[model samples]
Target: MQFTIIKYEIIVVSFVALLIFLLIGIAYLTLLERKFMASIQRRRGPNVVGIFGLLQPIADGVKLIVKETILPSHSNTLVYVLAPIFTFFCSLVLWLVLPFGQGHALYDFPLGLLYILAISSLSIYGIIFSGWSSNSKYAFLGGLRSAAQMISYELSMGLVLLCVILVSGSFHLGSIIESQVYSFHSVTLFPIWIIFIVCILAETNRAPFDLPEAEAELVAGYNVEYSSLAFALFFLGEYANILFMSALSTILFLGGYLPIIELIPLPGILWFTVKCLLHALIFIWVRATFPRFRYDQLMKLGWKYLLPLSLSFLLVESSILIIINPY
Candidate 1:
């Protein structure tokens, strides 16, 4: 009984630590993205708050908290209030099963990947509910678009994940990372890596796939009616989801926390962070470089292009593996 109490206490502490780390990362990621985007556009980012704008996110948080929240006259107040909370909670929940490095996850489950997929898909409900509950045409349209986009891309994303499961022979994220640990001549395979990157981008609604929140069309999409701290929650949740997807990609594909060359003695978490930043930078670069996709084009690419490609890749991988290791 004493040991069980100690185990429960440890679990609770670890969960709290994970939440702190995720919240801090979300805060800083906003600053990093703004800085990168400003440099890309040849402008100074947030340099006023502190040296190099290090305190900008903290200042923004304070401002949001102090600002008044405006609830629409005809809004469904209960859902309007709960939507962002749900979105934020769903985004954070996936971290519980995500392995940052070998044996460094908060929790491990046999179906960790599927659990992530399920949580990601459910996050759309928060967006849809927010839009519908806001009682505004713009919000309704944004919610509809978001739901469609998420549903369309999710199919391809699931197919792509299946390829990783096939390669690793396990749905547990820890086991997937373990499979990627290899010697000099035995590097991680390439095809699964490609699929993983593409899926992560689509899953996070990154540029070239950010149809739901196309500012020109949706005026900020599902969270159009949100203001002050309420809006901040949605913003934080979106960026956190982006970071989570990037980290998941790094873990599943590029070998989470495992150095590319393996000669470096850096901590595994350092490698994990570096890889995640690289992925996040690629997302920013794409946003800066590419135009947003039209809704139709976005749906077509997900269903016609990514879906078929991932399915075919899965089939080819299975066939090759069967031929090589027939029992």
Candidate 2:
């Protein structure tokens, strides 16, 4: 009984620590985006708040917290309030099964990859609820767009994941990482990696695929009615999802937590974080480089291009695995 209680205590503490770390990461990710984008555009970013604007995110958080949360009088208050919370919760919980190093995850479920796919799909409900609750035409249209976009891209993403799983022969993320000990998937599955990158970019609603929040037409989109802390919640949730996708990309292609050269010993977690950051930088770079896709263009790319490419990769990968293993 005592041992069980201690184990539960450890789990709770670990969860709290992970939550705090992720919140900090989300905050700094916004700062990094602003600074990087500003550099690309040849302008000053948040350097006024602190040394190199290191404390800018904290100031922004303070400002958002003090501002009054304005609720639309016509909005469904209950669902309006719950939507951001639900989205934020889903974004955070997906990390529970993501391994930072060997044996380092919280749950480490056998079907961790499938669990991620399932929970990520649930996040759309929050978006739909927020848009519908706002009772605004613009918000409702944005919500509908997000639903179609996510559903379209998720099929491609799932097929890409299946390709990885087939190569690894295990649904467990750790096993997938181990399967890459001799060589990374990025080499063998280069085309699939490229396709997965595009799929994840759309899945996270990042630029080129950011139709759901397009400023020109949607006018800030589904969360237009939100203000203050509520708005902040949506903002944080979006960035968190972006970082999660980056981590997923790192794990699937870059070999999670594996060092580049085994000859020089180093920590696995450090390599994992470095690879994840590189993927995050790719996301930010794409945002700076590409214009937002036309909504029809976005759908066409997902359904017409990405879906077929992913299916082809999966079939080839399965054939290769069967030939190699012959079991």
Candidate 3:
């Protein structure tokens, strides 16, 4: 039917547009991080390639693509190659369910949060595979560290998510954003929001929590053996996840697409973007500010500290909701 054909065409076009938009965002995020760090260190960063290094990310992509992909002689050829591809794929697909603004998400699922959590948890496999297939001890150890680190924070993050879901009373992401009636921060649950933000920093492996790729310790961690395009994919995937985490935090706690001031008038998408960018700045700032944690210290913080705190809050939140609503 002509209608069916039109629908299919729309789908294809939308997907292509989404892919382009996401890739461009990730590329600029790289540039943003460099420029931000440069400001902190009091130097110019990436200024030569184009106007203020606008084209630097594109040049970097092309350079990586042009370089030779060196496969380790003893590496498992299949999984080693597949690892970064898998990681990049998972990272990109997560954006599908994220609501950019009211009704503007590419795909709106009822349980979008659950979908994100499930997809994100699978990322560890890619890292583990990359490390194991490389046949390098450092890579293997780095992968192990990542696995353990992610699992630790994932527990706390899940609990954090539960608090949001409890407060919002909807699993749908758009509904959660809509529930935020006012922006700036959650009116009643600001502490939970703050905890969730911290949890996401660890979830995305930003600094203070970047043990997996601690340069001085793991020597670039699990992706060390990856060169050229493979390495580029891994790099892009990490940043993509970072942006997604920021977006998620915005949606959950910062009031997605909502203007901070009740009187302010701005397009919903612009507000959403500004909120996401602010969160992204926090991510880069944390990276610039904090020292990397000792591996044991990281585990202890996640387990002994964050996990219990999130759990206790979740329990308290649930009990309060029940008492208030009891009929």
Candidate 4:
């Protein structure tokens, strides 16, 4: 049927567009971090490649692609090669459920949030695979640290998300944004949002919590044995995850695609982007400001502090919701 052909065409086009956008976004996020850190350190980050180093990422990509991909002599070749590919794929796929703007997702299933959580949990496997396949003690140790770190923080992140889901009474991301339009639960429950965002930082293994790749301790951590294109894939995946988490934060806490003021006429996507960027900058800023947490310190924070607080808040939010709409 002509209609079916057209639908397929649309799907293909959208997929290509999304893929290109994600790659470009990841490329530039690298530049953004460099530029930001440069500013903090009172130096220029990149200024040679193309107008203010605009083409640096492109150049970097080319260099990585042209360089040799070294496989460790004793490594499990297939799994070692597949590790970064798996990491990159897992990072890119989660966008399918993420609503960029109202009705903007490639597929907006009712339980899209659950899909994201599940996929996020899967990313740890890639790290574990990379570490184990390397046959290097350093890489293996780094991967173990990252795995334990992610698992611990994920519990708290789930609790926070559960509270938001209960408050909105929907697992649909669009519905969650819509729920925010009037009540602004993110604002009313600011403390919970704070805890949620910090847990996110840990979940994503950002600074102060970046134990997985702690340079001084683990010599670049889980992907340490990777080189050239394989390493590039890990790099791309990491930045993509950062942006993805920022976008998720926007949806859950910052009112996704919603205007700061009703009177302002702006595209919802633009508002969504600005919010996402703000969340992203927090990731970068934290990296610049905080030193890495000791592994024990990090675990204690997640278990002793965040988990209990989020659980208590979840119960309180549920009780209040029940009282308000007891039908």
lDDT of each: 0.83, 0.92, 0.89, 0.90
Poorly placed runs, candidate 3 (over 4 Å): 1-5, 183-185
TM-score for each model: 0.95, 0.98, 0.96, 0.97
Which candidate, 1 or 4, would have the higher lDDT against the true structure?
4
Q: Model 3 residue 43 lDDT?
A: 92
If both were scored by lDDT, which would come out higher, candidate 1 or candidate 2? 2
Error of 3 at 314 (Å): 0.8
Tens digits of per-residue lDDT for model 1, 1-327: 999899889988998988888888988988998999999999999999999999998998999989999999999999999999999999888888877777877777889988998899899999988999999888999888888877877887787778778778899888878787773112444665665666667667778777667789888777888999889888888899899988888887778878886678999989999989998898888888888878888778878887888788879978988998887
Question: Per-residue CA lDDT of candidate 2, range 1-327, in tens?
Answer: 999999879878999999999889989998999999999999899999889999999999999999999999999999999999999999989999999998999887999999999999999999999999999999999999999999999999999999999889899999999999899999989999999899889988899899999999999899999989999999889999998998988899999999988886889989998898899999999999999989989999998999998998888878887898897
Q: In TM-score terms, which candidate is top?
A: 2
Runs off by more than 4 Å, candidate 4 = 1-5
User: lDDT winner among the candidates?
Assistant: 2
* Error in Å for residue 36 of model 1: 1.3
| Segments of candidate 1 deviating more than 4 angstroms | 183-192
Positional deviation of residue 195's Cα in model 1 after best superposition, in angstroms: 3.8
Ranking the candidates on TM-score from highest down gives 2, 4, 3, 1
Clashes counted in candidate 1 amount to 0
Q: After superposition, how far is residue 164 of candidate 3 from its true place, in Å?
A: 0.7
Q: lDDT per residue, candidate 3, 210-303, as tens digits?
A: 8888889789999999999999999889998998998988888888988787678889989989989998999999888888889889889889
